[model samples]
Target: MLVGLRAMLCIVSIVAALPAHAGTLAFPSTGSMPVLSFSATVSAGRDTAPGTALSQAFGNAGLAVSGTDCTITQDISVNGTLVPGYTNVYQTGVPGIGVRFYITAGWNGGWTDASSSQFNKTDGGTAHYTRADLVVTGPVGGGTTSNLPSMFIKFTGSCIETVTATQTLTGSTSVTGNGCSLTTPTLAFTLPRAFSKNLPSIGATTGDTTLSLGLNCPAGVKVGITVTDAVNPANRSSSLSLAPGSSAAGVGVQIVNGATLVSFGPDSAVAGTVNQWIAGTSAGGAMQVPLTARYVRTSSKLVPGSVNGKATFTMSYQ
Candidate 1:
């Protein structure tokens, strides 16, 4: 059984990348550029008024949406003429590259091509937004050099009641449009009020807590997890332990699936999988995999210090 000083539980997340095919949504319109990269700009706070514009650009700040009302202006541009239709750049996907931005997890309200400025020269186009995510396509109208266009990325959506992964940014980006899943950079389990508890007999019974993982992917996507060997890999059995500098003594954390201790192989290996799940269609809503973390008692007496462990969750997409 597990014991702790306080009653806090921190979930360790490690998403495995299992690439599959949903369809094709790549950039350049013609060829496939897998090594594409671009930084996003949320020029306003997530709490800004519904339709008002913010003063400046909040470069690469993460976003959290309550509904589809929290509004903001955003500018997403690639490094070079990545944005089709810049100068004589015609749309490879359509006519002139209008751009189609795909998001991880999902979004609340929906995005619209904020066409008020004379700079928004695209005569017509499409900016698609769903409860799952957003995609800005088109501007396949005529001649233009305006690569980076302004967008109205509002957070007023009606998908889930709380902050699910479908509405959070996972910092994972691709030049290709859609098809793959979108994820948040990290799934931080709330800080436990206390990390201390009573110690149960080894190989006996103890305590456990439930946790959530944020993943928004296409239909039929599979997920896997892994843990690093930063701790004592040889001394431990099938579970992982706390790294150096933990407050609790003779204690560690282990992920459990039912009764078995989930084996988290080396740091970044995705082959020897342990805990995993598949994403259902949108009819079922977003997929935030529920997991359990328990305190592993290694010492005879329950200490009065904290019991915390750290592991980097590297989310991979197929």
Candidate 2:
């Protein structure tokens, strides 16, 4: 009896010491439904090179991920209220939208396909399992009409079974170079006041500016950057845009995304869905992300008063 007790104690201790596979879900604002917590981790790419933002880096490197394994111990259903006609959805492998949930191999799980499907009841049929990912989709507005924030409380899709097990990451959780801040509080890109005068002709660009993003984080961690600032969110084109006030006329500004002009807003492409990053070196280095800023000439009715705008930014890491 004594020998048997000793063996049992050793086994229990071993399981207790293993890293836990647990995580959380975050909703941006109030009115969000209480989401069941899930395991979280950086992008699987992080498992590869430590600081390098793979070709999939959205902006900088750090992308917020729950983890490789996510389990929903309960049976729940949801649909979105952010917009009408387009809600309650999920898809496979980071499609830039939807709840993105799947089940994995484990005890007691049998799931139904979540493709374009809505759940109005406890998972019908036998219990199944799949790998899952609930991603941040763009809020509705301008050129985008999918996966609104309301999906948080109103989302319905694939589900995971609850089980007691250990799933430690084979990847190096060593994260570094993770602190990010805007070094340049303000950047003024130049658009010729005369360009406003051009009115519809689209005058030449007056000047340009680059905002610098400084990073310092755990060595192996990855980082990504996103621009949520735009004067007029409703007028976005996968980029940033300046809103048009009654006081100002004939011209609006647009932020440059690479060679193309992208509008600004929560739904714009400037959102941190792109997989790009400020990579770290083998020695756990640092990085500076440069954001290009310029003015796109919109409307021919150039009103040369005070041309001003602002945008807020955020950084994510895995």
TM-score of each: 0.35, 0.37
Candidate 2 per-residue lDDT over residues 91-142, each given as its tens digit? 2123232333333222232433233222222222322233323333432111
lDDT measured at residue 61 in model 1 versus the true structure, 0 to 100? 23
- Local distance difference test scores for all models: 0.36, 0.36
List, in order, the clash count of every candidate structure: 32, 75
lDDT value, residue 242 of candidate 1: 62
How far residue 160's Cα lies from its native spot in candidate 1, in Å, is: 74
Per-residue alpha-carbon lDDT of model 1 for 244-301, expressed as tens digits? 6666665666766555566555444232234321222332236675657766666666
Report the lDDT of model 1 for residue 50: 22
Each prediction's RMSD to truth: 31.5, 21.7
